[model samples]
Target: MRENTAEESARLQSAAKDHLWLHFTQHGTYNDDVDIPMIVRGEGINLFDDRGKKYIDGLGGLFTSQVGHGRTELGQAAAEQAAKLEFMPLWSYAHPAAVQLAERIAGYAPGDLNRVFFTNSGSESVETAWKLAKKYFKLTGKPGKHKVISRSTAYHGTTHGALSITGIAGLKQDFEPLVPSTIQVSNTNAYRAKELTAGAIDVTDEQSLERFGLWAADQIALAIENAGPDTVAAVYLEPVQNAGGCFPPPPGYFQRVREICDQYDVLLVSDEVICAFGRLGEMFGATHFDYQPDIITTAKGITSGYSPLGAVIATDRIMEPFLTPGAMFGHGYTFGGHPVSAAVALKNLDIFEEENLLEHVRSNAQTFRSTLEKLLDLPIVGDVRGEGYFYGIELVKDRATKESFTAEESKTLLHGFISNKLFEEGLYCRADDRGDPVIQLSPPLIAGPADFAEIEQILRNVLSQASAKL
Candidate 1:
């Protein structure tokens, strides 16, 4: 890729500043002095800016590029499919690409989750899952079971239905009157177990961790009963909750949640928008955790961001009602399963198998974890927790007291300093303040020890400066 000329770079920056609307971004930040970060190209877990400055893709392009970048084959797959059939609506019709892709995903999904409903993005997949849950319940004679239960600080998506299911109050307050009947329960953040569990369990050892897991899982059951179990349709949870900086399920957490869902006849929806397609060293996060969800909502890594696609994979039981003669779910999107997108997804999966991407993640996950854990030695670093190729390094005001930064301080520390500094230091990751302040890292599955070392060095330098500033 050629570097953008100074004039061209300036022109692109001006155009972006004038027209581009970045998601969840404060546009005001880009002023006369600060230019919008313009990424020109990507290859092998690295991104080059318009100015030709190289940086490690520490967040894997928002946790979407599982197979890294610059794979010409995925692009070729899209081109070939488009030449054959560019557009084919899945409404009242079926395409070979969609059908074959669905079958491939079903083969990957655990248990009886064999039915795939395609969408254009993760939010759509989530919205589709909730709708499916409600419709399935109504078909099964439980018309009132339409409510959803999710974890606190867990981010499902941005659409009204998915937003309603999201537990982040800040993200929902702007869009009031969301789809009702959604409830929030405690999440499985073992680092903050004592507080999240209301002092019910302090995670110090395996025994206490299990106790905390049970306590957290029991919260779902409690919410179900409190909301009237018959009125609750499903429970939406990410295998590793992403919004709160990659909070992995504690040991026995999902097992107990599965038992609870089974006991209550509630559908368990595993929202794997960020956890699927080799991110967790498994095709589905449910498989990684040894649990079976009634439905799995996935996107992002399916095509490695070479194209747009998403899916809501449900169990055979969830599909049983709609299979009856003349029965209809009455839900779909225009570009839900675009043939080109499906073709790209199939090629992406082929790459995964051919390269053993899942095994690569599994074999080196510990190295990734231990590499990030080295940051824990810093006083500002409170906790480094996650699984597979994903991880989060929690920043705190004081390590001894576990005191996090206040809202204003967090804004200054994370957004004002850390975010920009990390980029300037040649690493692209998230310095988030969604819950407490933390740095979230989810490099591509192809990343090895060398990549981890580079990430660690960048983080160590920037975080040490952040600590000194505090």
Candidate 2:
């Protein structure tokens, strides 16, 4: 990695501060004193900033880089595809790259999820899924079924339809009067089982955990009944909910949710934007969790973040109505399946198989979990939850009582300190308070035991400092 020249760095800083509008960013934080973090290059599991400082990519580049970074093959694939066929729309015609990539995804997706609809991002995939669900019902004579049910704090996407299905109120309050009839249900966060279930289940034992799982799954059924099943079109869920700090579903949770969806004629959508493509030690999170979904919305690792692409994989039954003569679902994106992106995705999947990345994750996931669990010895560490390479270490003010920080404390501790301190220490991970203050880690699937040790050490140092301040 080459360091940016002083003049080049100044130009970049000026252009960024003046012209660049970062997503979900607070631009006010940047100035002469506070420089914007400018990542200039990546190789393997590490990233190099403009200043040439190397840091381990603990979040897998926002949980998108499954095969790690700086894979020239992916870029070459994109170039070759762009040279052959630069632009084509899926509106009325298809290209070879899109067709091939869709077929490959269908092969990897679980159950009868064989129909692929492409988009440019996770939010678009989610929006596509909701529209498909509604259209499917309308075509099947249940036009009234347009409502969706999702878990509390589970983030689906940022587009209006996907945002409506999203359960985070903070992210939605600013964009009021969203799509109507999206209901919230209890999530399977076992650590918060006592609070989620109102003291009915504490999750002290396997039996109690199973009971809590059933209770949480039952919440969807209750939501459906309350929302009027006739008006419910689908229930969207993540295999492991991401927003509330990587809450893995309790055992038998998805099975029960599957049953509920089937009983109510509701489509089960597995939003795998962040969990697909070996992130959870499987091709799809649904496969890892052992459940069938009527639709699966995914992106992120599809092209390993080398290019933007997203997809909504639907079951054959969901596509049956639209397959009729002259019948159209009436939805499409201009860059839904860009040839270059599809080619990149195809190449990315090839790397996954060639390197046995999924197998690598499965073999090393336990080691990663145990390494992160070592943080429980810290006073501020309350719970460590998640599956595969994705995990979240929840920080509490009091470990014994599991008392989380107040909003101001969370802002001051996480945003004000831990986030930047972790980066200064050369480990790039997320310090999020979307649900509670947690250090979210979703390293690349290719990461091994050595990488986990490094991650744990950095986290230990920064979190120890944070605890002292608290």
Candidate 3:
């Protein structure tokens, strides 16, 4: 990779500090700390900071860069499409790349999700899904069905509609007066089941899976009842809730959720922003979990973050209302279905197939799980959980008692020790305080057993250091 000149690096850093405001960040800290990080290049699964220091991209570029970075094909595809036809709005005028990518995504999406509405990012995809659900209900003469539900501790996005659907309270306190019809439900974090269950999972001889599944799935039904069936338009969910750590759906969980949604006359929106596009060893995370949603919201891996792209794939039933000759959904963005992004996505999907990335993740997922589970020997690691290339290591105060950190301990340890140490040690995942102190990892889908071990070794080293300080 070509290196950034001293002059160029200094100029960019100055501009970033002076003008470019970072999102979901603290601005004051960058003033006196080390130089602002400028990731100049990336390849496979390694990222190079501006100073040319290399680090394993442990979190896959905020859980987006599944196909990895610095792939020349993605760049070439973008350039070729831009040169030919740069900007054609998905509004009245449609372009080939957008149309083609939509068809491709519809084909890959499970069930009857045949209509694709493109957007610029995950937030927009989420917003699109919520709007479609509400409008679909209105069109079907159930205009009273306007409320949406999601699990607690999940992070949907920053847009108002998406933020309203988010489950974290601390993040939304400032953004009050958000879209006024969102509800929260309990998420499936089986590691914390001791509180809900009288004892452990009871993974004994016969009903281990059955027992866990029933307990977890009931939470959604309970929430639906509390919210009242008539008012709920949709239930938005991630296959593995990412915010409160990666809590994968308990066995048979989605099946039960499906039944409840159907019974309540609610749409099931699989918000696959983090779990989609081969993160879970499949085109859609819904496929990995064996559930068919009425709508699937996706972004991130669609183009491997080469360019911005998001999509809301809805079934014909939901879309029919908006396109019945005269009626219009009346919602869209100029850059939502950018031809360049669509072209890049096509090439990204091509690379996924040619390299067999999804299959690679599926074949090696067990190794990833087993290697991370080995960290259980460390007392601080209470739970090592997730699926496919995505996973989270939940830290705790005690293993046997399933104790969690105090508020001060969470702030000091997660924000102070774990976050800094991991970065200092050249690993770039997350030490999240959103739900306990967890070291989250979702490397490129192409990673294998060796890469998993590399991640484990890094965590093992840093976490042990963190545990000692605590």
Report every candidate's CA lDDT: 0.93, 0.93, 0.87
lDDT of 1 by residue, 1-470 (tens): 68999999999999999898998888988899989899999999999999999999999998999999899999999999999999999988999999999999999999989999999999999999999998998999999999999999999899999999999999999999998889999988898998887787889999999988899899999999999989998999999999878898888999999999999999999999999999999998999999999999999999999999999999899899999998999998999999999999999999999999999999999999998888888999999989999888899999988899999999999988999999999999999888998899999999999999999999999999999998
Clashes of each: 0, 0, 0
What are the per-residue Cα lDDT tens digits for candidate 3 across 289-317?
A: 89989999999999999999999999988
Give RMSD (Å) of candidate 3 vs. truth. Answer: 1.8
Off by over 4 Å in 3: 5-8, 197-209
Instruction: State the lDDT at 88 in candidate 3.
Output: 87
> What TM-score fits each model?
0.99, 0.99, 0.96
User: Over the stretch 1-470, how does candidate 2's per-residue lDDT look in tens digits?
Assistant: 46899889989999999899999999889988988999999999999998889999999999999999989999999999989999999988999999998899999988788999999999999999889988999999999999999999999888899899999999999998899889998988899899988998999998999899999999999999999999999999999899879999888999999999999999999999999999999999999989999999999999889999999999899999988998899999999999999999999999999999999999999999999999999999999999999999999999998888999999999999999999999999999999988889999888999999999999999999998997
Better of 2 and 3 by lDDT: 2
- The 10 consecutive residues of candidate 2 with the worst lDDT sum are 1-10
When summed lDDT is taken over every stretch of 10 residues in candidate 1, the lowest stretch is 194-203
